[model samples]
Target chain A: MSSFPPFTRLAASLPDHVPFVGPEAIERERGTSFAARIGANESGFGPSPRVIEAMQASAGDMWKYCDPENYDLRSAIADQLGLDVEMVVVGEGVDGLLNLAVRMFAEPGEAVVTSLGAYPTFNFHVTGFGAKLVTVPYRDYREDLVALAEAANANNARIVYLANPDNPMGTWCEADAVEKFLAEINPHTLVILDEAYCELAPASAIPAIAPLRPNIIRMRSFSKAYGLAGIRCGYAFGPAELIRPFERVRTHYGVNRMAQVAALAAFADQAYLSEVVGLVAAGRERITQIAEENGLKALPSATNFVAVDCGADGVFAQKVLDNLIAQGIFVRKPVARGLDKFIRVSVGLDHELDLLAEALPKALATARI
Target chain B: MSSFPPFTRLAASLPDHVPFVGPEAIERERGTSFAARIGANESGFGPSPRVIEAMQASAGDMWKYCDPENYDLRSAIADQLGLDVEMVVVGEGVDGLLNLAVRMFAEPGEAVVTSLGAYPTFNFHVTGFGAKLVTVPYRDYREDLVALAEAANANNARIVYLANPDNPMGTWCEADAVEKFLAEINPHTLVILDEAYCELAPASAIPAIAPLRPNIIRMRSFSKAYGLAGIRCGYAFGPAELIRPFERVRTHYGVNRMAQVAALAAFADQAYLSEVVGLVAAGRERITQIAEENGLKALPSATNFVAVDCGADGVFAQKVLDNLIAQGIFVRKPVARGLDKFIRVSVGLDHELDLLAEALPKALATARI
Candidate 1:
């Protein structure tokens, strides 16, 4: 073999596959912009006005690097969660944090578990790190917590990832069920409880943030509910002992400076967050109503997006998604066997949803043919 | 083995040491702010007005995620460099890219070579990835290319890191010298040529962008010259084949949306960059004059900072640094044995430099006592 800049054995073995292609790439390919952009579960209601103002004010200060320690933002997050500042670690986003978490916990060739069609970014990190991914499929459109614990024990998995108020399908396990699931996981297996959508989730769907556990890392993001996805800020909290190790492997200044400022401002303006939460709830209902009008069944969701079953198979659901995309209404669907029958739509601005409502019937008619 | 959240063997063995402590942390501890903030080599000149405007304009759009592909920014960088977009990869920063590059090339226990007392963050990533770092001492306050090349050959290093217009010292190697160094390296050993400060260096220091080599990855940043360090945007370009691997491991949306917008504007406003570069050169001269006035020798610099020799040992230089800090002026110094006698001071505004000038004599007097 040619020895021109040899990559590591594992890196060489990994395929070049991105988890999700951004809608921008599709727009570039199609030479047309999506008329209604609700595909990726981003909040079209946008960030709190205070956040925008804070970001604008800090624009000139971009010449200085961010506080590598992420002190203030982490402190605020800690205060809200009723945890010590040392128990929280901030990252570029949940995506960036997952990469660090997987690297820390999973040695190459070690087993890691997640639902088959859960977050693709987690799967990407596991494979990128050369860990064996043992996936347990969803049961009844929810992450099968019982199966995940069993798989973790069976494979002696190093890490198990579960997204509460999960993505692709917005079903969630209640607090008590999650508490029982945690009890069943082996102590050696680190649980990555990603709650990126938690702020948009029902209060009943979330467990109390206190009484932090060593084997569990609960991650939350400004991306989903706070509507700061473009800024790329997220954080993971756990026991201080578990959190301290992140310093060993993190890109210290990976979190952007403006992100810290925006997140701090976003966090402080609880009124705006409450408003966005209310708006998101209303949008979800609107989407469900639209789905019903089109003779599809929308799954019960605690997330910012709703998964509407197409009343058909995976292929038919895919055709519906394609037809929606062609009609300039961007949407996505789960790719796994059982979940693929559903088309996922994010809560959007009223105008965007109106466009979605206008296009759904035509998309369905075309998809049926 | 109590078995509570077991980390990888490498992570378990790692110490919880942050590479560099932020100035904010120091202020929090001291309960006082630095009057002159020039410690971390960030541009005191700030980013271009157009860049700031771009960032402010895009603040409200933070609800949308950054394009994971980094298409427009990469295209702009490619256009500026006269290279195909395929040959370049954008990252959070040179620090972030270093983490990816090290993980891509170095397996556990593999040797990675760098000059001793170079960029600490690079060393952090090297060790963080379980790579053994082989170091060569700088000769005459400059990174010793001959020693580094020999070290790589002797140790069979998987990767060798070299920062042109080197950090902590602000010294640079000429293009011809670097070309010779690259020619001597084994093709199997990848070279991470960091030119983060290249925009501030003389044209003779930068190698031509064309005639890309598979084994050499040239990394540059918007942080130093464009004055957008807080935005955390950097790029690396090399042979397209080598650049392709970065996609396999990078956090798809790690680069922030505001960062991309800010960097694009910064790159476009070359006139403003030229103006900042001129101001930086003037500031460097002023700093050199301040060192001379204080009866200390200032090392020649190609970057934005001057390393002032205290005319004593590392201990004496450290005293001067501590006294300067205590006197409300922020600065840093090299810690490696041979270079530790010099206190590194970044170019600041005239008023800040005056504060440095006024404090330097008092600091030296206290050190001498």
Candidate 2:
């Protein structure tokens, strides 16, 4: 145990495991680029032309530091949400906000609750802060909110994480159910409602942005339907007191100037966002159709991606995913026990879906063999 | 105490004081933008044309999430520094990296040593992580290496932060003095060697890249000399063992995609960097000359900023700063006791510098009255 340059006990306990293996890393490993990159749930529909223009226009302003207050961006987001500006705080992304939220609420060795296969990034933050993770298994491939509420109470967890219109599964709960789940959790247990995929979800799936709760921080991102994943901007809104503490802990200039400019541009283009959503809905249907054509069942999705049941087990789904990668159509699958039979694929361009459609049967055949 | 939705004891103890109020916030309060944004020590020279071109070229690719590995950018930095890729880790900025470093090394209630009023952002992080900050006052205008080393040893500090070509003062120690300071610190204490302004410093001021010490993590940034502050990209390099822990705690996709592209292009365009460095040097001389004309003494700077002493107290210096802001020339002053008499001005464009020169005498007169 060489303790030279000693790390904190928590840091030493952490394994050097990255939460997500980026597609670029996979491409490097393969010594070639993926022909259709649909692995990471990023919007394959690029940002609005206006966002690209805004980014290009602001390219020369990179010498200036970001406005640490994030006034304009927060004001826009708050105005849209029908909330006061003080209720909102912007961060690098939903991932970045989660890191701050966990640090604020979860003390070392205290429990934090989430679904078994919810966002690994949240779990990463919780563990990074030395908090114990208490997981509740999904029910019918959806986050079992009731079970999560129960687990938080059972463990006296400091934080509860739930991603609506969830990732890796593409299933969702309606506003009423979420509201009930919110009411069931203890006020001491802070709830992080990560709505990263909210734009792609049906309106019924999202709660009205009113009656702000003291314990709940609702997160939103431009990375999904707005098609600016690379910009890494997101915001969390809650009670004013809850939002104020973030100022005490956050990296003041963490949100880059480009992100502020691009997100503002993206937020203003509601027409472009709606257009992307429609396209994403259409892409989701095409993916479902592709799954049916390959004699597999695609789960219903309110997200930009569809989860197709590969009709076997975790091993089979992994084999199918690997074969898709082998064929240069990057795809991923759930790793949780009950949900592992599904392969998740994002809605890409028509040509990319064509690549997926062309490669799926071959991938399935190889998995069968 | 109204502890519902509890924050950690450490978080609750922190004041909502932002480390540095951004120039934009000041402008907002004044209900107008600054004529010359020379504060924050950001390069007003702007990023290279090639970097801007790279950003514009990659605008449409904002739909794709950044490569979490930061592979290509890390490889480029490692190659230039004559170090292994594993030794280098790209972060959102040096600010973001400092957050990680403090978290990794300093446990709650443990001492972390640095000079008083060195970099408030580092102090912000130290307190944010619940670490006990033990400060040694600056000797003269420079960061007193002897006092810092003594404090680290006496306190058994977990980490010691030193910025060569120190911020707010622009004073630096030679490589030999720094090497001696490094040798004096205990092996168990981590040293965050921030060389953010290293590109502007003379060659003799920077220590050699090789013979990497186990206890030191050297930080460098594109935010300063490369003029990419808005992009929020920087890297830290050290022994592989120390660098590996960052992956365990960092926001993997925090550095936006445009940052990666722009920083790579910026790093590749060395001619533009040298040109900017030359321009900055000339600007420093002009600022010094202006100080002389105004009958003020400007500190010799190894960075892009010069600190002009007001020859009075902090109150008089602050009044001069306020008057300069009133005239629409943004600048800052060190808030530490000994350093507070001086106002820090960054090297801006010729036109911006003209504004500073035009305003300085008026500002001094106002302060005197």
Among these predicted structures, which one has the highest lDDT? 2
The Cα RMSD of model 2 versus the native structure comes to 1.0
Off by over 4 Å in 1: B1-3
DockQ of predictions, in order shown: 0.78, 0.81
| lDDT tens digits by residue: candidate 1, B1-369 | 234888888889887767678888888888999999988889999999999999999999999999999999999999988999988999999998999999999877989999999999999999988899999999999999999999999999999999999988998999999999999999999999999999889999998887988799999999998988898999999988889789999998999999989988999999999999999999989999998898888888889899999999999999999999999888999898899999999988889998998899999999999
Candidate 1 structure quality by residue, lDDT tens digits, A187-304: 8899999999998888888988868877999999999999999999999999988888889999889998999999999999999999999999999999999999988899988989
Model 2: lDDT to the true structure: 0.93
Off by over 4 Å in 2: none
Residue-level lDDT tens digits of model 2 in B1-369: 347799998888988767668898898899999999998889988999999999999999999999998999999999999999999999999999999999999988999999988999999999999899999998889999999999999999999999998998999999999999999999999999999999999999999998999999999999999999989999999999999878999999999999999999999999999999999999999999999999999999999999999989999999999999999999998999999999999999999999998999999999999
TM-score of 2: 0.99
State the lDDT at B307 in candidate 2.
95
Considering just chain B, what TM-score does every model have? 0.99, 0.99
Q: Look at candidate 1 and give me any clashing residue pairs.
A: none
